[model samples]
Target: MSASRRTEARLLSHDEQQLVRTTHHPAIYEHGLDALHELRRRLRALRDRERTLLHHKMREIRGKAEPRGGSFPGLADHPGRRRQLFAQALKRVNAEASRLARMTARAVIGDGARRALALRKTGEQWLRPAPSPSPAPAPDPRPRPNRRGKSHIPGRQVGSVSQANRRAQAARDARPAPPA
Candidate 1:
């Protein structure tokens, strides 16, 4: 065979194909790692934003012009403006905190999934066998006690003072007047 054809034939060997198959997933793993890193960075950014907003709110509450130990003057003493700013800052901080929490949760779940996949790829058996699902308990055969019955006055209707007052007033009005 010609030299180029020989090289091509070598490239198409079973071992070469197997090697490619074995190493093909590195790109996928690398992508997963990159995504995890990005998520961590975003979580940090959100946390920082939340901290800054909280500090601003604290300063507003204390009637300080600037944050503690800072040279800047505190905010103006307008209670309306302070209230508005405090509300706005609180909203922003809450939003950022929520976003960070969600991102962290997602990152944790994603990392767990990736680790499980890696473990599966390594062909190592779990230390313990998975627990077998237990059968559901049988339903009880005894009949349930009947709760709905006459003479069981519901609490709402039993002790209503307004109803009692109305009944008493009707009874009083219905009585015949004494002879003049």
Candidate 2:
């Protein structure tokens, strides 16, 4: 962080402290944390909204720039130029939104601002378009051996009782009941 940013952070922290002192309510810190989270959420939402709007404007520009059928033979390149202009506009808007989000994060988030920034950066990195997947490896030609021995049965029937146990239970039940 730059010196100016450090000073600004300190000032914000001081202000936050003052606010906490004035409130004097139990769970004030929890409330403050909630407020910080809400601020971050709102900023991110605003960025998303701005990005969507820019995308829409880009589409509109593309539509307008395109020449109609049987319109003009020499004007085909105009659409490309217009498209470039719209793309630049979109980029500028996205950049400004990012800057504003950074400022808001710096101002609203206190001690954990650095962590939050790092998390945001990682999140953005994660959201980037994924690279093409590698080719699947060839399956092994050799058949896999069963780990269990012959005694081990695959997919045993549910509630199946052993023959020996059944016989033993039957014998015990068949025995004459002892006089109570």
Candidate 3:
């Protein structure tokens, strides 16, 4: 790929970055992450295409490299040259992928920082102790009007294990004895 196209594929346009920062956008979207995804998609296609070309076009490329009737040409299928070429391509792909990862990480950190700042600002409001009108009043000695009922027990708690055991024992006592 050309230098310009390579850069474009790996990074968002300047205008995109500006829009992201300036607009009231949803939290889920990010230009850098989108770029990274696109880059990966394009890279996958590129690797597949390049692999196909390497298999199909090697002979054609080697033929073009053949020495004509006049001038001398280097080895048409030099093992060293072929290895170096592919190594260089692999290095470039690795570098590009690494660059995209770093950029995405930076974008994520920045987004997290912005969110934390917003949370801090909002938290500050809630953090300030709410102003109570006065000291908390003492409790009344009398029970509340609604506290009485046939369903309510004074001290023993409902749903206790002991309550269950007592009920089971009472039920056994009430049942008639089994025939001898």
Candidate 4:
């Protein structure tokens, strides 16, 4: 919140932003950021070694002749340009790092939202009563045996029962009938 993040949606608080930098992994992310770092470092090195480079180039070209601006006019701005390039590349890396941090903050927020929704659903479930188990409607008292005749309970195979169905049936059987 020092200024603002351009890459992400405006959401996180300052503390959350701090958390984003350290906690959520700033991924190498396809080597783009690392490459920018390399570029910036090389540019700074070039700027630092400017005198040596100029002396080498001048000695190779001319033994004793002094250089004037007309021969190498751009040389005057070469150090500035190198410095500028390094700063720009550093700025690019900083921007991308900020973007990754914002993304991580967004992910933490999303996960929290999901967890909060689950908690809300659980709260509602705990507040509400579970449906009572009930016996199936009256079946045929004189139904014939399975395989050769119809089942006592319609739509239910004579011997086919799942563990859940068995548990439900046991629960139903265990409950005494309510008084009229």
Candidate 5:
């Protein structure tokens, strides 16, 4: 079988796949049936939401457009104008909804492509061995004492200031005096 053909291909819910078969116009072509199904689901949900909102708006406009119980001749024509305006507004709403669907489809397709590219990059980076860091400069070899005298005698306490001073004075005394 060709690499593109899937022997074990599964349909997205047997009934829903047919409903979602159509590709979105002006959207990047999706390769997987699952992706197409998902896009269709999203578009349907968006359309449903828009429809609900538009229905509410139409109801509100209708409420505002009803003629009162007055017998005025001029008032009779007002409802007709209102109906015409409502129809125009409904058309606008539908146009906006279609635009939103197109934009959503485009965004979804783009994001999927970007994610795939990032995943490929990550896989490539992971496959390559990381460069070895340069060896750090060797640390100083001098011995360091912890708050004690330089002598390595165990258990010796050498933190006293007076004792250090006395040791220094005796060392100075033992040295021959500088020639006059």
Candidate 6:
């Protein structure tokens, strides 16, 4: 009888090794599956919530279209009142839709965050550390002066206020008095 020898296969790189391990390791695979499952759950819940919100919105719109009271003798006959009610109802529905859109967007963003966290915990090193705060900006070297230029007003000599006051009085006297 002849004995046969078996050879082991070698992985080309660290990434290949990690990939092989992830596929073969039961614990790692379970964690990864769990993360995926959680993501699906979150997506399903978001969908269900959106559907429920849409249904409620439709019900509200329908309720608004229906008159509250029995056919009135005079008030129901007014065309303006009906138009106003319709306008108000449309506004309310638009507002509700806008609110629901914002909520849906937030849910999607939250799911993305969760997925990012999962990816990070799973040994994915794509995320880099935040850069250290730029070294406190070097202190500016230029020296600041304590005070600005001369305090005296430009183009006027010192003690010129008296001359300005006398000129103002002469101009006032030159103007004719208003009719009595």
Find the candidate with the highest lDDT and give its number.
4
lDDT string for model 1 (34-114, tens) is: 443443354345345445655675676788845535443333223233333333333433444465568879999999999
Between candidates 4 and 6, the TM-score winner: 4
How many residue pairs clash in all the candidates, one count each?
A: 5, 0, 0, 0, 0, 0
- What is the alpha-carbon RMSD of candidate 3 to the true structure? 15.8
lDDT of each: 0.51, 0.47, 0.50, 0.52, 0.48, 0.48
lDDT of 2 by residue, 3-89 (tens): 233332333335433432322233322344345445345434534544554465467668854333454344232433333333333
- TM-score, predicted candidate 5 vs. hidden true structure: 0.28
Put down candidate 4 lDDT per residue, 1-180, tens digits, no spaces.
122243211333344333233222243344454554564465456445554545555664686655543464443334343333334434555666577668879999999999879989777553467666776655666765677665468565545667669999999999999999
Give the winner by TM-score: 1 or 6.
1
**What is the TM-score of each predicted model, taking all chains together?**
0.30, 0.24, 0.30, 0.32, 0.28, 0.28
Question: Which segments of model 4 are wrong by more than 4 Å?
Answer: 1-29, 32-77, 124-180
Candidate scoring better on lDDT of 3 and 4: 4
**Candidate 5 Cα misplacement greater than 4 A, ranges:** 1-68, 73-75, 124-180
lDDT tens digits by residue: candidate 6, 70-151: 5534422333323333233234334444555687799999999999899979978777878778876558767678787777
Tell me the tens digit of each residue's lDDT in model 3 across 4-72. 323332333354323222221332133354553554455455445445545544555677544334532
Worst 10 residues of 2 by lDDT: 1-10
TM-score of structure candidate 1: 0.30
Mark the 10 consecutive residues where model 4 has the least summed lDDT.
Answer: 1-10
Better of 2 and 5 by TM-score: 5
lDDT of 1 at 70: 44
Off by over 4 Å in 3: 1-76, 124-180
